[model samples]
Every structure is written in C-alpha cells, then in structure tokens.
Target: MDTKPIAYTMSEKENPAITVHVVKKSVTPNVPSGNDSSNVTPTTPVAPTPSTPTGETIKQPAKPTIPNYAAKKGAAVYATRALYLYKNENFKNSQRLVKYPKAKRVNRPMFVVTDYARSTNGVLHYKVRDVNHGSKTAGKVGYITADSKFVVPVYYQSMPKNKKIIIINKKGVNAYKDANLTKRVKNYKKGTRLTVKKIVKHNLASRYQLSNGDYMTANKKLIVQGDYQIINY
Candidate 1:
C-alpha cells in the first residue's frame, strides 16, 4: 500500500450528446349548452283584419199621377182665387209676369191651355194664353198651377140627374137637327137653360138631345149641368 495520486481520461466513442423535439396543439371556441332557451326556433307572424262601413243610404221621391177628370189641353180654366202667371213652370216670384184676381163667375178671368208641364218637384202646370177679352194681359202666354183648389174647368163634364143644363160659353151655342152638328137651326144665348133628353156621340164628341128632339153640342166648354147661383169674389 504505497501512497500515490493518479489522473483519469475518456474518448468520443465512449460519450454521446442527447437531442429534444417540441409539438403544439390547436384551441376551439366555447358553444352554448343544449338546455339554454337562447337556442329556440323563430315563429311566423299574423295579419290584421279590415273594418266595415256604417252610414245609411238615401233615396229619391217618385212622381205623382194625374186625375182623369182634370182639365186637358185646349180646355178653358178659370181661377177660383188670386193666382200669378209665371214665365216658366218653376213659378218663382222673380218669374211672375202678372197677378190675376178672382172675380164674378160671369166675368172671371179665363185661359185656354195649350200644353202641360211638370215642375222639378213634380207639380203640374198648364201652358196657356190669357183669353179674358179686353184684358190688358190678353193674348199673353205663360204657365199657371194646375191645382184644382186654385184653378178649375169652366164647365161641367157630367150630366145632372135633373136633366137641366145651361149655356156657359161666352158666345151662344147653336142647336142642330142632327148629332153631326152640320145643320145649325137655332142659337141659344149664354145663360139659357134647357132640358136634355139624352146624350148622343158623333165624331168623338158628345151632343145633348133637347126635349124637342133638337141636338146641341155637349162640349164641356159650352155647357154646364145643374143650376149654379151667381158667385162673386
């Protein structure tokens, strides 16, 4: 056991270096859970309804009918009360041509109808000529109301039960031997009273057979049935 120090040494073949390799992993985003209410599906929309109308409807008035006994064209008409003659059927105050006053039956103002017209309000009117002899308004043409209360036929159409008839025409009527009124035999003055036996028809007109077998025109403008008292207004 001798006391001595010694050094050690190693070759490249006996020592080797070690090498390390690093690998990385990718990260993913967070997602909602299946139990969350934010994952619900959308619903469809609805449409609104329309409103109804509530107003009332209006109607127009109907026209009135004329009476069969009413005076017609070419007939004489006289006013029972004061009446105004109008330039047109409208009968406005501004269109008034003259005012006719009611008078005694024998001298009452008269008019001869030429035609008929209806107002916008369905009132009836007569187109006529003022035929009162010697009147300042004579021969004037105009329109007047056809209201029976204000105006009426100058003569009567129906026969009276007593068979009495009077001449009403301003001019006298003539008696004939035949119903045709061809042979004029005698003339009866206005206001003359006569009795009729019967009525005869010829040429679309009527004639009255006198008690003496004479025939006279039964024209409504010429004669009236019954005895009427003299009236003054």
Candidate 2:
C-alpha cells in the first residue's frame, strides 16, 4: 500500500550525472472548539512552487586506444637446433617474420636452429633456416630475437652415430611414423622403455627414431636424456 511518487533528474552538463529524490508531503487541518473560537487564530498554508524539469544527459565519446607493441614483444620458447621467429619482428625494411608452426599436440615450433646469440638489450637471438613459405630468406640464415621471459639457453651436444638410450618419464606417450607425430602408431604407457636409433631435433621438440622405425617425442618433459638406466618390467 505505497502512494509515494519516485522522482529523478538528469543533468544537462557534458558529463551528466543522474540523481534521484523521493519526497512525501502530508497536511492535517486544525479544528478549534466553539468555546475557544475567539481565541483561536486561522493559520494560512504556504503554497509550493513548481520545480523545473531536467533534461537527459548526452553521453560523451570514448577516447581512442593505442596498442603497446613493446609489451606484446615477448620471448618464445626455443631449442638449440630450431626456433620460430616472432611474427612482430621484421628484417630491415622487410616483412614481418613468420611464426614457426608446431606439430599437432606439440608445444613448440619446428624451425631448424643453426646459431644463437645474446643482444646488448639482453634479448636472445637465434639464426634459423626457414621452411614452408620459401620466402627470399628461405635456406638463408635469418636472425630472430626472443624475449627473456621465455628464453632457455642450451648447450649443443655432439653425439656419435651410435645408438643412444632415453627413458620415458611421463604417462601416455604417443609414437608416430613421422617426426611430427601426426600419424600415431602406438601409445606407450608410463615406465615403457625406448632405444633411440637416431635423435632428431627441431625448434619445438626432439623426435626419437626407434630401432623398429617408429618415432616418438623426446621432449624434455617426456624423457630424461642422461645416463639413467632402463629397467625391464
């Protein structure tokens, strides 16, 4: 049972604000007794003035936004033998560099790395051979810098053509016919053993060629690359 009127006013200023106010008015008539009619004075009621109506506020246009390319210039995870260049960095008066695409389910790109160096700004730079697009820079060594946040320096190891052993440290690893792990040939459970016939590495990860001719990922997370002995289950 509410009978109060709700009122609101909008400011006409450039940056207008909305305000709301609620008001209630009540008046009661005073009745005098017949014996005190002469002594009682009639009081006059004050009239209320009309309030001016307010107009709606118009919204102002939003300010234009500028992108910060510096913050977007970040480091990419790279391997000693391969790395993907940042799409944001371009050669002198050249086009933006291509990003090294990764294999399916793999986290890193597939560029073959040839050399790496640190710039004066503490950025890590890698020289790699390009593929796919076959741009003018293809087959030639092109330098790409990596942000420090994602750079991991690695030492190059020269191993003989002899067989090498690596241990699987993770669960549910996939073995494929190719280095890209596209056509899965088998799924290896944790504790499975693998004898590496040949170790091939690209920018994103390394692939191990088994004696049986099947290949599996040799990512740092999937296998330990040291002298850890394999135990027969």
Candidate 3:
C-alpha cells in the first residue's frame, strides 16, 4: 500500500547516503471516562469530599469530556532513502526552478549499470541510484514529482541501466521463502520515481551483505528498472 511518510531535512553532509530526521511528535490525552481516575491519588482509592448539610459526606462524581487525539502507543518509525524532485511532477510537494544544470539521462556516474529492466506501454525503464532532493548543498532529504517533461531533462537517447537494492541474508532469503519474516516496507524519501528500461531475468546473487558478517547469494528476481530525475528543474 502507498503510504505517506513524515518528511524532514538532513544536514548537507548526508547526501547519497541514508539520512534520518525527527519529524512531528504528538501526545494523546488521558481523560478518564470512568470513576475519578485522572485526579485519583494512589494513597486513597475513594476520593475525599467535603461534608454536606447534616454532616453528610458527599463524594465527587467523575467528569467525562472529549478526549484528545493521539496515535496509538508504540507506533513504528518509517524511514527511507532520499530522492530527487521535479516541477509539476505530481509529488507531495512539487515545485519548479529553471536553473538546475541539465544532464541527459545516462548511466549515473556513481552506481554501476546492471542487467534489469522494466517498461511502461512502449517506453523502457532503468533503476536510478544516489538521488537527492532540493539542493544537494542543503543536505536535506525530501520528496518531489515530475512528468515526462522532466526538470533535469532526461533524454531517452540510449537504453538505461543501474544497480538494484536487495536484502542480503541467507536467513532472510529462507525466511522470505517461508513467509516467516516480517515486512520491510519503507518510505521512498519522498518524490522518488524512476524511468523504465528492459529488465534482466534474475539478480544472479551479485550483491549480498551478511547479517552476521557472512555473505549470502542475492538471487532475487528483477521487477522494475529506470533512471530517476526531477522534471524540468
């Protein structure tokens, strides 16, 4: 399911890498609905009250009101890699600027091109890596969207290629096969999208990271591929 992640900025020194920032935090109110719980003192279970006429003691009744909104306790933290932004890109916070230097779409200088591909209608796709949003100088991670009329201006002159992400653990592979592992969904660092190229059949176990520092094969199948850009920056 497509979910909206909390957006924030990182320091300028954190580009092309995993960056995290604290967003908004809220607290839930604890208005008591039952007997006097809010004002209840641990020393005494029954609340004390003043004496009424004829020396009769009167206990105060609990007051109930609208409770404050709070997210459920123990909420999970959502994090993801930062991505590029473009003008009118249908992203959450899309903006336009015409000053960014135009770089024609090609294999990114950082990530090596691999054999994986995807296509939409007739246009091909490729995976983009080390994407940044806003100014890389700002060191902020954000989201933006772009259309075919891209801001960075990616020309489909040649077929695109790039590396893909994978979870690298033999136990993770075995757990994935048995459905015993939990989910690992993360936000796309906002405004992240990729272009499509032809896909290679299998991952070939080329990239693997060890959980206990032991390497595992990465035979994961290819699903999608594309270069990423902010449209018409």
TM-score of each: 0.57, 0.33, 0.17
lDDT of 1 at 107: 68
Give a tens-digit lDDT track for model 3, residues 195-223: 32222222211322222222222232211
Off by over 4 Å in 2: 1-162, 201-204, 227-233
Residue by residue across 56-169, what tens digits does model 2's lDDT show?
576798643322321111222343233345433344335445544333222333234555554455454555555324345445446665443333322112332445545454
lDDT of each: 0.78, 0.51, 0.29
lDDT for 140 (candidate 3): 24
Q: How accurate is candidate 3 locally (lDDT)?
A: 0.29
How many angstroms is residue 219 displaced in model 3 relative to the true structure, after the best TM-score fit?
19
C-alpha root-mean-square deviation, candidate 3: 38.9
Ranking of all candidate structures by their TM-score, best first? 1, 2, 3
Pairwise TM-score winner, candidates 2 and 3: 2
What's the CA error at residue 178 for candidate 3, in Å? 24
Ranking by lDDT: 1, 2, 3
**Candidate 1 per-residue C-alpha lDDT over 134-170 given as tens digits, one digit per residue, 9 for 90 to 100:** 9899999999998989888764445679998888766
